[model samples]
Target: MTETLLILGAGQAGAQAVLSLRQQGFAGRLMLIGGEPFLPYQRPPLSKAFLSGALPRERLLIKPENFYRQADVECILDIPAVSLDTAERRLTLADDRQLPFDQLLLATGGRPRQLQCPGADHPRLHYLRTLGDVERLREHFLPGARLIVIGAGYIGLEVAAVAVKHGLKVQVLEAAPRVLARVTGAEVSDFFARVHAEAGVEIHCDTGVVGIDGGADTARVHTAAGDVMEADVVLAGIGLLPNVELAEAAGVACENGILVDDLARSSVPGILAAGDCSNHPSAIYGRRLRLESVQNAIEQAKTAAATMAGKHRPYTQVPWFWSDQYDLKLQTAGILQGHDRALVRGDPRSRSFAVFYLHENRLLAVDAINRPAEFIAARTLIPAGGRLDPARLTDESVAPQQFA
Candidate 1:
């Protein structure tokens, strides 16, 4: 009898798994389920190109409709998997439909973390996580509108950049001491704060929102610093909460995300988890990580698919990510956390440079600002985990290719 593999969540990982399982010659009864109505689409561009009117909605799809039909994969869309029974290997959809599987892949991804303050449920307040969310927010992106953004993370900053460019008066409120404090060093964060300031974005770090008072026309945001700011619209991008409730309900192990091994196998046999909803062990980092990036989703799904296809490929890909803001491209390779030292390679005053993160002289990560060559080189160097000369890293005369 042919095995049936059911994949939940039609985001990047689910869609990638569908394509990869076929590529790996699974030839099983493959089915992909998504809660959203549309096909699997890219979420990264939702705040940047898609929100700015530069890219159309059609271009966001991971794979066209014909690809699924041609590959003989079954797609159940717009219906969420409401419950899971690991013992029975069955999933129940929101519409009361039951489906059994020989193996399962959980890729439910994550949802935006909303503010807990009062009046947050007001229609004027927004969170950018889905296509519908962005579309709704875009309706209020009028020129001369007062837009108050809460959180200084990538999503908030990206929205601020686009709003400022669209002629809206934008203000960003971050509870942290500095913008991008959680991800980058002080130098990188300071540089971006300067960039946004010059671009007409008002950034208020060390400011915490206490409550929101929403009226028919505008909303007033009260901060902990004893100040209230009114805005025509409010957008929050605080963080993400992984979609692991279904797995947890079914007795699957979960912490920050669904627990999985390096090969993407979960605590339950014949079941795997990947993407933003999975916290898998990283052999290189020697710790478990739950990454919320497109790279992690794609690569981890490939590993999950390979395992289901009877292949023995371990997932040890050096994670990489990129963000675009006001003509600035920040490409990062590896995880910079826990690095003992950070070195700058070019002049930030010139608007192009790279920050190399080292731990005990070993190259751990690199944040390349408008520097693609170094970013590419860092992707290769990080996996090798080799020690490098600190003097040569900061030398502008030396090229990235020579680092290896």
Candidate 2:
């Protein structure tokens, strides 16, 4: 008798696990399932190059169709899993087909958080989470079009930047006091707000959306201040809600996300979770984290594959993320929260600099804007608890590696 492994949600993590399992010499009956019809694809570019018409649809695929065939992996696409029975180790699909597995991996990821206000269901309102969403939204990215963007997070700002490049009149409405407020420090947020403003992008911080009303041709956005703004299309980039209903329904432990150990094992036996759907303990940060980045999905899936392969590698690598806007590349390493002091290494006015976060002389993280060297150095220094003189850190004369 041969063992069988079933992977749920054919996204970044699922695709990576399939490759890693083969590399680990798993030699089992491998199967991948996804709700989307397309093969597992790269999502980061959907809002950047793909939306800008720079990258084609074929380039978005993680692996070509032949790869799955040659690897002898069965891919079940376009159908969603309906239920999970942990006791019997069976998964029921939407078509009423039930499959049994020896081990299961949940990489169900997440979906865009939708607007709950009235008229949010308007046909012109859009949310960018899937490739189909981008394709539909791209049709309305015309020149001189009035676009209203809700939320000032990464997805919101990235879409706004792309919209501006396409000659669209873009207006970003963020309920928070500043753009990127929830993710970065005050100085970083202010810097981004200034950048967007200088690029002809109208930004409204501290403004909230109340409701939406529209006709067949256009839509009207009602703000909390009783101001009504009309737009050809509206996009909401609020945030994401994890896809944990199947796991929750199966009696799996879940908080902010599915609670998992460093090995990617959930509370239930013979089952594991990864990517945006799972919350695992991070020894480096001394806390649990639910990260929604490409790096996290790839690396953590490798860990989960290793565990399933009877390996002993723990998922303790330092977390890093990056964002591309206009001509700027913002790279971050480690968690910036709980820092006592933040130091700027280069001049922000020059549009190139790095901010270092420290707690009691220990390096916590680094936010590097157009500074690749500083970003690379922080990746190693942060995890090693590297210490540096505050005065020297602020001086650009010293190189980042010198601090290490």
Candidate 3:
């Protein structure tokens, strides 16, 4: 008999798991379940082109309906898996139906964190995470309207770029000293700080909204620094909290997220975790990380599916991420933590440059700003553990080909 695979979330990770299983020649019965009522879709663009009216909802889908039917993948949409019975290897749905599985993958994903201040729950205040939320938020985002975004993180900043393009008044409140303070270095934070400010964005650093005042027609934001900004719409771009309650209640190890091993296996023998809902020990960075990027979901789900299909291999992939801010195309390769030096090979003011984050004596990561050559070169730079000389780095006359 073929094994039964029950995937708990139909987001990027869950959808990739089904695709990976088929690619790896797994002859299993696959059943994917999600709370959303649509087919699996790519989420990164939701905060970017989707909200900006550059892309339609149909283009966001990762796969077409015909692909699922041809793959024989059973999909249950608009239904959430409620409870898990570890001992019985079954899951109870909201309608009281039991789903029996030989193996299960938890890709429950995550939800956006909301502010709890006064008037936070007002109708004007919104948080964007799903396609439905994006559709709703886009309605209130009229051109030339005032938009107050709380948080200077990735989503918030991306939305600011769109609001600016539409000629909307944009004010972003960040509690940290710099934007993306914990993720990247001081240089990166400073770079974006300047980028947004130059684009007519009112970015308030070292400040946070203490209370929200939703007036009869406008929403007013009262900051901790005693600054008040009125807005026609409010967007909460705070971080995300993983949907680990189901895993934690089922006795799965839960840390910052569902604690998974190298193979994406949780504490439960038959249970596995992947994507935003997982905090896996990254062999590349030597620490546990929960990445909400499309790269992590696809790569980690592929590793998880391979392991579930009887293949034994450690999940290790070069960690990379990117963000699109206006005409700036930022491509990053490798994990850049614990870097002692940052070498700028190109010019930031020219808007075409690359910043190399070197750790100790080895190359850690490269943040290329519209420089595809440096970005591609650094992919091999970190994997080979190559040494980069700071003197040759800044000299644009010396090509990056020498490092190869």
Give per-model TM-scores: 0.99, 0.98, 0.96
Query: lDDT per residue, candidate 1, 1-404, as tens digits?
Result: 99999999999999999999999998879999999998899999999999999999999999999999999989999999999998899999999999999999999999999899888887789999999999999999999999999999999999999999999999999999999888888889999999999999999999999999968679999999999999999999999999999999899999999999999999999999999999988877889899999999999999999999989878999988999999999999889899999999998988899999999988888999999999999988887888899998898888889986
What is each predicted model's overall lDDT from 0 to 1? 0.94, 0.92, 0.87
Clashes of 2: 0
**TM-score, predicted candidate 2 vs. hidden true structure:** 0.98
Candidate 1 wrongly placed segments (more than 4 Å): none
Among residues 3 or more apart in sequence or in different chains, the pairs in candidate 1 whose N, CA or C atoms overlap within 3 Å are none
TM-score winner between 1 and 3, please give it: 1
Q: Which ranking of candidates, highest TM-score first?
A: 1, 2, 3
* Pick by TM-score: 2 or 3, better one: 2
The lowest-lDDT stretch of 10 consecutive residues in candidate 1 is: 395-404
Give the alpha carbon lDDT tens digit for every residue of 33-126 in model 3: 9999988998888889888889988899999999889899999999898899999999988888899999999999999997988888778888
**What local lDDT score does residue 91 receive in model 1, on the 0 to 100 scale?**
96
Error of 3 at 11 (Å): 0.8
- For model 3 the TM-score comes to 0.96
